[model samples]
Target chain A: MSCIPQTDLTKNRIEEISSSLAEPAWLSKERRLAWEKYIATDVPDPKADEWRTINLNSLDLSKLKTTKLNPNLGSFETALPDGGKLPKEMSAALKQYKEIAGFIWQTEKGTQHVYLDPDLQKKGVILLPLSLAVNSHAGLAEKYLTKTRKFSHDNKFSLLTEALFNSGIFVYIPKSVEIEKPFLLGFDFVGNTCEEAVFSRLLLIAERNSKANIVNVLLSSNAKNINASPSLSLVSQLNELYVEAGAKLSYAELQDFGQHVFYNSRLNNYVHKDAHVDNLSVAIGAAQSKVDVATYLQEQGANSEVLGVVFGTANECFSYNTIQEHNAPDTQSDINFRVALKDQSKSMYQGIIRVDKKAQKTEAFQSNKNLLLSNGAKADSIPKLEILADDVKCSHGATVGPVDPEQLFYLMSRGLSQKEAEEFVVLGFFNKVLAQFPVPHTLEWLQGIIGETLCTQFQSQAELKAEAAVLVK
Target chain B: MTKTILTIKDLHVSVEDKEILKGVNLTINAGEIHALMGRNGSGKSTLSYTLMGHPRYKVTKGQILFHGKDLLVMPADERARLGMYLAFQYPVAIPGVSVSNFLRAAVKAKRGQDVPIKEFRAELKDNMTKLGIANEFLSRYVNDGFSGGEKKRLEILQMALLKPEMAVLDETDSGLDIDALKTVAEGINSLASSDNAVLLITHYQRLLNYITPQFVHVMHNGEVIKSGDSKLAHELEAKGYDWITQELVAQA
Candidate 1:
């Protein structure tokens, strides 16, 4: 672990990533400027909300590399209908990584893909790699580069992401054009053997009357296999999902990383008046992960839905930070998050709904529910509301407890075993959060995964109650 | 010895520091039905609960023996599995669990093994029909949004499925209409067996009209004051609790 020396990220790596596609010089300069912004912004120093009552000194980010896009060495193959059906176009976009308006890391073996519908290309849509966006579409890229993401936040991981940042795509849907299919990018992160780390960045600009769905998935395979052969992969992606007077945008990120690496991600959005944005982030599995997602509602009827779901178990740690900003009058935002914990796993949910004075009639709601099924498992939810608008309705609540005993006993008495009874109670506990996001199949998948984890980390009441009494008393 | 299944000797119990039963004693043998009738708060339901060993009900200077073994020594679940069942007067509703699943668990707990799916469904359907329960009720949550009569029917339906050696029907006829009363009484009558006994706790003598009891006992302030044949129930119903109280006062 101590044999490797620290390396500094310079303009060369950024240029190489852009020049690999022979991207014009202007885009390369913009990449350099974005890297400079990465330098200027400090890493985040988590406040009480992020790490309350928890210790996280084991996260060290000093010795890591800014890696190149070494796509996974394999053709896409999967019966799973999601992103597997279109391998031909995906591979075409994969090789032209630097040429596309938006560049993203694919989940399959360092697979990287881009989105460029020929029709939109004919309409002069400046969608390509972030480097190209900076060089070729400098005016638009600079104005929106770090507009949504907070890279300057005080944190070592943020600083590392900024320092080593290189990959990710840039997308801009020109005025009055519609792209029906979702834009997807997968990143496979394996830090060890390759000695290369990833800090992928994305910039998305949807002009007035433009419609699109950008779906990016972050993944890591254990290929760079050796332990602390450590390549730090941090992705600071920006989604300036502009919904001009009449535009619509849907952005989603799925983080399913290798069970042995650290994943640091930050995503944010800025929506304009009369525009709509929906952000859905699902984090199913990860070794150690931190996600920051927020949306700024800038004008009247500028609505946003910020939804997140996470699963944490065994030694996994999940920290989530969400900020919903209502910056315009009649603007609305809804934020909901649910976490399931088992074994020694831990998850912290800290979210705030802020309503500025000018943002009157802003109705904001925040809720966090945690299901703790093990003696060693722990969950903390810190919900906050800062309202400067006297006319706004803002409220937040958090709940942490074991399943209801009476409810469990009642079910057990009917014919269900003790385990079956508890499963029902736990499912009922998060029914409210599930209602906000009407995706039942995803909810069922999450429920099954949690139930299996509960089976392993479970101890009967005799074992847990006695242990709890001794500790609390 | 006529195979006495339940033998209560001076059973005194209290719940949460309040005395419910004071020196109550009763005995019933298999192949016979015993009816314990009393007014409200006479400890009729309390005796049934204490017999099942509810954790909150502490037995004070008493012994509840079923088939010559102490009932107070076992947990509620074990008591249930040991062939003793209670048909709750007001069934407790458990949300988010289907009726079929709940009944299956109770049966398994009593039988101590997983029942085969085919046989389980056939028996469950038969019991539901016997209790006048609709097939759709099996899919809904346990007693959630069920009517008063439906809850009572479900309780008795459980009694039929568990087939306990002895059953304590606590006011199972309280909230039933004429049709429901007839249906529930018929269901109970159909389950009667020479190998099992029934302890019917009620506030009315009307239910006994359809399903006759071999013996009847009058409970006053936790003790059985009078015991007689089925005609005793008719005589009490003809008059009222006041008639017996007045007679006792005259005798004293």
Candidate 2:
């Protein structure tokens, strides 16, 4: 056990966390192995190609202490229909949170609550806390938990999450069952203090011939002045999705946290034969965020479509790495991720489509488009393909450019202000992919988030000009 | 006598530092339909764009006045809100912004308040039906993927919706077929009234046959070289631009 100062991430503390959760012997052993891997693997090398743009040294892992569980941890009060007593900022965010999520499971301030729709429960769907699911669905959990069998975790962050996660949810859809309404799961790491780290996980299993839709929203609540502190809060999450043969799953995720938060999340989906998966993700908030999304087509006749939208303003930094891997014959994958950058913000996208030797007749497509709205704004887009099969069809493309001046002048000629003109053009640029979401309301919600970001960006400039005009007056 | 709606005094406009409109002058009063006809490079489009306050067309040597207010100093959108409209020769496509939303926003900006939704929808439907435009266009992105005739009709539709005090139609009739030209001409004719005026910039006299202009002007070398009744458009269409240029050279 290596001693690490300023953080409770030592071996003893990790093992104690496992014991405190009252996990089964197998799970405890699993955590111990993950801890061993965490200690063995060093922090990511900044010079590595994937980590070149990101400043890994700035994140002081030692200062990010593990969250202390409060004995009086109560249910998620703000999630109720009639809002219970919560802080002003939390309650305000929850009002919007309630509208998108039908079934809510939120972990905040070291407390976790699980809510399942009664109609869904009657239909034999199971949504439970991860702790309870270990005993109730022991066979299922044991088989699939930490099931990144072929893709080993060479990164220290994944190992750290596996070793330290204490709060999570398990969602299971039975065979041939279809839920009309999508499920919503929220993981919030909130704190008033300066130093805290929250680790959470999600494991979703869709059985054969079943269909499900889920929306996961990751958020954080922190004091406005917390940015002044050298170390504020760290939110780390991992989600694994398993879609069986002849099944379909639509998953959408949104990462919206405060400026005082650094969010790290990974989403991995495995699709079997004749199954379909649609994944959409939107990243708009956070001081710094790194997200990895991977979809593996594990059998013949599988298809996966992934779409992502990211908007960055001010000094926010976001990176998205995606992979579409075809392991079997007759698989198809398509991916498109668009980013709009304004102010002095920066963004980068790395996408890969891999087809193995045996994966003949495979078709894959990927693209990343970026719009830089300001001179100081920067963006990097890289699209790669690894094709071992001569009979496969694969293509990738990327583009980085400023907003079209002609388009802006066109809108301005129609009596729209410059800001409104830019917002309209940007929204149109993203709608090519946003309109593809399976859930209709999700498109509207994503548009609202993009709209708010643009409004803040241009409104501040307008206010500054107005103040200057007043001073001259 | 009617009041002058717009007056340009020796307007010299340049794009990329190359002078496109040099010392051009024109005037239009309320209740008048005037057509400015010229050859391809005769500065007709440049004059319209400069009058509409397009930033690319720098008014280096002259002034444009709308209702006695200097229009050159105003931005493009400010010119639009001040009852000046330009039907572009090439309408710009704003993808993902619905036609209905665009019109509503334009109406709001012109009126300085949001038009009630019900009222706006009713107005859009009424105007669309009148112009032979289907209701489906209201849901589509503005000018995106529309055919030549469709873009022209949409321009006229916007002019009708905005009801500007003065409109500069820049080659709105160039790419339209005979049937579409008549339909668009009727749309323009419907919008024309005693309270507003129209300045038509076109290379052909086909549109003038549908909507008769009370006055016609010939443009050469970025200036209006001749002004007469509608017969001047007919004379130009009959003899082509060479006949006029030959006469000008002979006289010089």
Candidate 3:
């Protein structure tokens, strides 16, 4: 395939990354093909209708260096150098961070560590690094990895990540195996490489009748509040999931990157007949982020519930796009996204529920509710529904407004301060979606971050109000 | 002297630049139940919300003293923490917050500390049972999808749990049937004690029949035009509020 290259990304860098990783010839070919697709797509244009609303023109993609692959490739739970000294950049974020699950921590320096349940391994569950899987389970990796979907002609970022991703994660559950414990993956960025743009891929597959829960947490070790710069940190990741017939998969992703990081991620879920997929996403930290979640109900009796909560503060910008595609008869999908923005933050959400022509008896629902905590904060919710199937039931609702004054007053009349009152109301607003989270500890972790954000935002708001009060005097 | 739980002096209030409470004054001492009855739009609910320090209800001119402290100067939450409560006529619905969770939060805020979960659960159960409330109501969202009677009972349930020094029931009897009304009134009557007072703001005289008030004050056009004992309630119920308005016009 011949295509004109649009970005400044060079083919030599792509080849160098592939050869340095010592990937198999077929895997190297896959990388080249993805690079071709990435070259064919133009760098996202701010003038385009889809990109006009998104603020990516300020992002200097050229200054972001490709991540360097660490040669150590240590075992799971390997200790860091310097007597296991914690990275200075991440000490504060760690203090506020609560442990969700025993995660496989992979840092930019290639320090990979994990605590996999041996009992699960005994039951024929496979949790291995993606590069290792490419060599050890090549057949499974080739068949399942990035095979369910093709690269879109317009999504250059996905193609870019697929082409140059040096660190990848792979999880597989054998037929009839049901794991009670969750599989956690942590991608932590360290070092002072603010110019490094990290690309990662995660492939999760559940065989027929198998069930598993997976949690993917993306974060940077740096805690300092930094501004967007030409050398700003960027983490672009792609997750591909396949649930076979009668299988069940519960997947969640928590994105809390550093203050200066720009994150773009996508999750594509392919659910088969009689299968079920439950997805919960929580986005809390990032200077600017764009996330997309799409669930395809490909067969009858397949169901998916998508829930998400976005809490942004300060000058952060976040945009989330979701699609619930029903392609078969009797398939159902429901989506709910709740967003809270404070200070000068901004959030944009665009969701669509598409029922194909043959999809009869399909039921899909989409709802987006937003809360603005300050006058400078803003949010846009655009919900669309395309129903080609006449028999399908589809409904969508989008609301963008401030926190309900009545709810605030109600909470206040119960003895909570204005800060506490707003926090409680926002928490309650997200409780319905969080209730869908399978793991209890994960819910607790999300609630903890939400509480912290609310407190910080309210404190700043009080200070601003005091300043204004003084000016009036 | 019996301590006054709440005292309102020359209180003038407005909502959306329109005057609501026009020079209203009242006082309720501890251990007493005072009934303030008025027709619709007569500022009965306005006074209830104003005394509770609602932000929109501007107190243009007045002083609200709760236990000798200036209530108007304090935030609504502070007043609530200081042992004041309002049973709203149309309680706001908080969709995802369950009744039990809301109560626990309210209790923690009121008491300024965490209530042991076990103790909180037990007290919630006790209060719910006392109000003839079912256990399932505790798990449902606060006032969300609740029937009118259930909302009233939940308000009573909260009042029972907080044990506020002064409880203001703003038309708590509006949407209740006779049986539900009796049950709610009984719940309020039990909470009235020597250390606490009850302020019942109602338009109908029926609620007083179940929970008798020590003082009955007829509010006409935002002022307490007449004051008497329990007999006053029956007299108004029979003669109707028209007589009070007629008497007020004549006096004016």
lDDT of 3 by residue, A211-322 (tens): 8888777776565644445445678888888999999999988787876687888888999999999999888888888888989899999999999999988888888889
Models ranked on TM-score: 2, 3, 1
Highest lDDT model number = 3
Please give the CA lDDT of all the candidate structures. 0.68, 0.80, 0.81
Off by over 4 Å in 1: A1-4, A7-47, A65-68, A71-109, A112-263, A267-289, A302-318, A335-347, A370-379, A459-473, B1-252
lDDT for position B210 in model 3: 93
For model 2, the docking class works out as medium
Off by over 4 Å in 3: A1-8, A47-50, A77-103, A146-153, A191-193, A225-230, A463-473
For residue A135, model 1's alpha carbon misses the true position, in angstroms, by: 10
Higher lDDT: candidate 1 or 2? 2
lDDT of 2 by residue, B99-215 (tens): 887888888888888999999889888889888999888888888899998999999998988899998899999899888898899999999999999999999989999999999
The regions of model 2 sitting more than 4 angstroms off are A1-5, A69-80, A83-102, A110-112, A222-225, A468-473
* Alpha carbon deviation, residue A201, candidate 3 (Å): 0.4
lDDT of 2 by residue, A1-473 (tens): 12234867777776677666666788877777888888888777776655665556546777877765442353533234434554332343445444433455465544455566666677778886676677788888888884753466565776777877767778899899987567776666555554567777788999999998888777664435455455546777778889999999999887778777777787888999999999998887877778888899999999999999988877778878898999999999999899998878888888988899999999999989999988988899887778899898888899999988878877777687887888888988887788887865677666776777678878897798899999999
Give the range where candidate 3 chain A is weakest over 10 consecutive residues by summed lDDT.
Answer: A88-97
Residue A451 lDDT, candidate 3, scale 0-100: 69
- Local lDDT at A242 for model 1: 54
Q: Model 2: clashing residue pairs?
A: none
DockQ, candidate no. 3 = 0.77
Return the DockQ of model 2: 0.73
